[model samples]
Target: MIRVRGTVGAWPVDLQIELDDQDWAALARQASAEPATTAAAAARPSGDDPLWSRAQALLREAGELEGPELLAALAALAGSDQAGKRLLVRLRHCDQVEIVQRGEAPLYRWIAQ
Candidate 1:
């Protein structure tokens, strides 16, 4: 059984699929046929990813922005709050980003490399 729960374009999605033995075998076969490099490349995020590139570009263009404000923009771009939050977390840990506490809020600044 495969369960997927997430949002797609502002819509919440919850799905479950139960696969039989044959289906599982077929899936395993397809996965094993793929090149190891392809799987590894897909798992790692890169500038080639559109959402990641755009998220970085948005922060770069802003120079600096408050956490909530930047999160709202990212949420809009990502089409869901959860997705936006994921991007925000990534930005918080990014080498090019500097985070500072201002009162109760966080300020995210893009440091040019």
Candidate 2:
């Protein structure tokens, strides 16, 4: 399980994803295949940047998102760095997901099972 915590707008959200070793390895392989263009690389947050830290937190929480849904989530979050809002929208559109939350706050945790 990977645990991630960060803010979406004024609210804070936490994300967690459970993956076996094989799944993790597969993701690494896929990421490694992508072309590492300088402009594309620059778009991502640096380790020292606060936004990058937040993005990492969100990614950790997101776990094993794949396909178009994953692309949409990344686009939305990358556009505004609002993971919680982007997640809520994605969950509403996806048919194979389970979302859990504490009360009415924007904070939520989801699994794509």
Leading candidate by lDDT: 1
- The TM-score of candidate 2 is 0.31
lDDT per residue as tens, model 2, 1-113: 89999999999999999999999999899878876685599865354755434534554577544434444565566674465445446544444443444454333233543
What are the clash counts of all predictions, listed in order? 0, 1
Error of 1 at 110 (Å): 0.6
Model 2: residue 91 alpha-carbon error in angstroms: 32
TM-score, per-candidate, Cα-based: 0.61, 0.31
Which residues of candidate 2, in runs, are more than 4 Å off?
38-113
> What are the lDDT figures for the candidates, one per model?
0.94, 0.57
lDDT for position 82 in model 2: 61
Report the number of the highest-TM-score candidate: 1
Report the alpha-carbon TM-score of model 1 versus the true structure: 0.61
Worst 10 residues of 1 by lDDT: 41-50
